[model samples]
Structure formats: C-alpha cells, structure tokens
Target: MSVENKKLPQSYYVPAQSPWPIVGAIALFFIAVGSGLTIMQLNNSNVSGVFLLVIGLAILFVMLFSWFKDVITESNNGLYSTQMDVSFKQAMLWFIFSEVMFFLVFFGALFYTRNLSVPWLGGASNNVMTQQILWPDFQSFWPLLKTPAGDTTQAMGWQGLPLINTLILITSSVTLHIAENAMKVNNRRKLQTFIGLTVVLGGCFLTLQVQEYIHAYTELGLTLQSGVYGNTFYLLTGFHGLHVTLGLILLVIVYARILRGHFNDQQHFALQAGSWYWHFVDVVWLCLFFLVYVF
Candidate 1:
C-alpha cells in the first residue's frame, strides 16, 4: 500500500502530465552535449564544455530535488494506492536490471581482454607467427604489468585499503538490513541509528576509495595511460565508485525522510527501494573485488 491511511480505491490514480520529464530530458541533453565537448576539450581549448556541464548538473540537481519533493508530497497526501506501489516496485527493479547490464558490458570487456586477446597475443595455440609479428617480447600475464609498448605499471592488490573497503561495504549491507528490521518494528531510534551508520560507512568507503586512487596515481604510476591494463582497471573500479557515490546519495535522502517520520512499516517503499539499490551496489562491489582485485 503506497498510502497507509487512505482507504484503497478501486480507480487507479494517474498523475497529471508534469514538467519533470521534459526538464529531465533537457538536463540529459545538456549533460550529453557537455560531456562530448569536455572530452573534445581535452585536446582543444574549448571552454563551453565545462560551462555546459555545470549548468546541466545544476538543472539535474534541481530536477531531482523538486521531483522527489513532489512525489513525497503526493505520497504523504494519500494520493497513492496499491497500484502505485506496484508501479514503483516494478520501476525500481527494472532500473537495477539496467544497471546490471551496464556493468555486464565492462566485465565482458575484461573477460575478452584477459581470457582471449592476451592469451592469443602470447603465442597461445598456433598463433606463434601472430605474436612474433605483433609483440614478440610481450609476456602475457593476468595483470599485464608491462605492455607491448614498453610502458610498465604495478597492479593494485587486494590488501590494505581495498580489503578494508570491501569489509566496510559488507558491513554496510548488514547495518542496512538491521535498519530495515527496526523500521518494520517501528523502532525509530534503532532505525535512525543503523541507517545513519550505513551512511557513515558509505562515506568512509568513498574516502578510502579516493585515497586508493591517489596512491595509484602518485605512487604506483597506474593511470589511464598505462595501456589496456590501466584502462580496464580504471573503467571497472572507477565506474563502480561512481555507482557507490550515487547509492550514498540515495541513502542520505532516505535517511532524511526517515528522520521526518515519512516512513512507517506500511509506507516505506522509498526506503525499501533505496535499500534495494544499495544492495545491488554492494553485490557489484563484491564481484569487482574478487574479479578485479583478488584475482
């Protein structure tokens, strides 16, 4: 039930056609244009790339805040019913499914590079002539530290910050679960405490991630320029970091709503959806840690 107090209505409620969709589309357009220009500006001296990017980001922020406000208002006003609740659940599930596919593409790239391309280049099968002509001295390894172009870099290990961050994320999942349980029992204090802990844990993960990046760039000489190894490494972990950041933002919003008592056990889809997204993020990280870091 989307609204706890409202009696279930037979007629489905449809929101009026709103400006948010168009506003979101406009914001995406600007962001797309800005991203392209910014990438192009990397070579040339174009300044509008960054300017448009900032404007797009601002519009996006406004849209998210206002759109969420509208939704929350509608929800609290008992304008929603079970139909609306089902729609929200389906929407969230599909959104997460799309995100999974997005990451799947990256993981596929990693697989193709490591399992097929690298091995074939290293004279696997009868491709000895191919290796001889292409990269005669290339020593095929999982990390591929030394590139055929003679650029060398160190692989990031699963020790220290990476390991600690992995533990932090796992613990966050536990805390979020406890928070959900507390909410179910109407234990506001426990709910707030655990959810707040989840937020702090998320922040700590991001902080450590930044530090890890710094160490990679400054000390390890691992960067985007270090051939396919660096490219895949950064692409996988960097995008995962971005997802984590987004998940943290969601958690913060849910926490704020919880503080306002916007959610009781019956009317907590927002928190439930937020938790679902966060858990999905955690699963992605686990895959990244094992496949990208441990192995």
Candidate 2:
C-alpha cells in the first residue's frame, strides 16, 4: 500500500452538527398532523390539511436532498475512512433491522386478530356465550370480510395486478443484484443499465399498485371504512407501498451517482446501502404477498 493510503485515519469521521435531523423531525410532525387532519376533513370542503401535507412533503424532500448532497460531497472528497465505512454499514444494517421490527408489529396485529381475537368473538373455544350474545351472525373467517358491525368489503385476490406487481418487484431485486455484481466488476455500463431497469420495474410496480387500489375501491367496494379487513389490508399494503416508493427514490439516487461516476469497484458504500435496502423491500413484499394475499 502507498504511504498516503496508510495515512488514512483509523478513527471515524464525525461531521459537524447539522440541522437536518431537526428539520426531518419537524417535517414528520407536519406530515403526521396534516395526514390526520386531511383524513378527518375528507368529507368536508377544507383544503388546509392537504396544503400542510404538501408543504411538509416538500420540506422533507428538500431536507433529504441537502443531506445527501453533503454526504456525497464528503464521500467523494475522501473524508470517509475505513472506520467510517464500517460505521455506515452498521448504521444501514440497524436501520433495516428496525424496519423489520416495525413491519413485524403490524403483521403480529394481523395474526392476532385473525387467529385469536376474531375467533374468540365468533365463539371459538369457550366464547360461545360471547358470540351468541354479542355477534350471533358473525362467522370466524381468515379475511373477516363481513364484520360484526355489518360492514362488508370484497377480499383482494392474489391473481391479476397483485401477481404482476409481485413479479415486477422480484425481477427488480434480480436486476439490482446484477447491478451490484456489475459494480463489483467495474462494468459501469452494465451497472447503469441494470439499475436503470430496476428503477423502471419499481415504477411499474407502483403504477400497478395504484391501479389495484383503484380497482379495490371502485369495483370491489374495498376501502378503509370497510371494517377490520379493509383496515389491515390497507394499512399493511399502504405502508409497504410507501416503502417501495422510498426504495425507488433511493435507487434513483444510486442511478444518479452511477451517472456521475461516483462509485467504483472498491468503494461504493452508497450503492451497497441502496442495494441492501432494495433487497429488503423486495423480501418484505414477498412476505406481504403470501400473508396478505394468499394466506
């Protein structure tokens, strides 16, 4: 190794205090409050909630762009040492782990409601009296499409758009893997092509998902107000859709980085992180496909 290379610090690079965190928190606060108010005002004529939601999202995008710009500048300037790279890797790992736990909570709720709570309400085990007195007409079902409150929604099937979206996401994962391998071999042309294809696949998946939501609401009468079935269905799938949107954004950023000649075969932590996240999103979709649709 060259002497200059050996001179690279073993300590991590800690950037000076930044306002991005606070800005991000403020953006999220607005998003949460605005979303709540917007949903509440859905039947009303007021548009203030929608305004705030847009402003919040705009601020969030600005914050993300500025933050990533700073990171990219530092990275290209070689401010990040080996230790810093390890720290970044660890941070990405933990972030993905936290996301897994976050989704697990919602999945756990679905499982509990399906296996225990609904069954109990429908007279399973020793709850015969409960069912007879409270919900005599309610039948325990995996989907619980017809709630005790009489609200009904058509169940989303696994075929058609859902299956197509599944194939798109799975294929995107494969493309991303190919992109990563191309990056490893320093084949920038193949890397850019594969990653660009992955981005297109992601966009297709999102388009299909939106179409599916429209079909659910317009054709099947499945909506957020359709009781437990609709609630769990939308919540789980909605959050996953948001994740896919974020993943698409990340992949786009990575694609831009590739175009700018940012990453090479040796040091491409940003690409690696983005690819890791994309893979995680793909895995989560597989789980959702099976649990929410098939099972």
Top candidate (TM-score): 2
User: For model 2, how does the per-residue alpha-carbon lDDT over 1-295 read when each residue is reduced to its tens digit?
Assistant: 8887686547678899999999999998888889888877877899889988998998899998999999999988888888898899999999999999999999999999999999999899999999999888888887877755676778999999999999999899999999999999999999999999999999999999999999999999898778888989989999999889888888899899899888889999888999999999889999999999999
Kindly give the number of clashing pairs for every candidate.
Answer: 0, 0
lDDT tens readout by residue for model 1, 169-208: 9999999999999989999999999999999999999999
Task: Quote each prediction's TM-score.
Answer: 0.90, 0.95
Quality of model 1 by C-alpha lDDT: 0.91
Q: Candidate 1 — worst ten consecutive residues by lDDT sum?
A: 1-10
lDDT of model 1 at residue 93?
Answer: 100
- Evaluate all candidate structures by whole-model CA lDDT and list the values in order: 0.91, 0.91
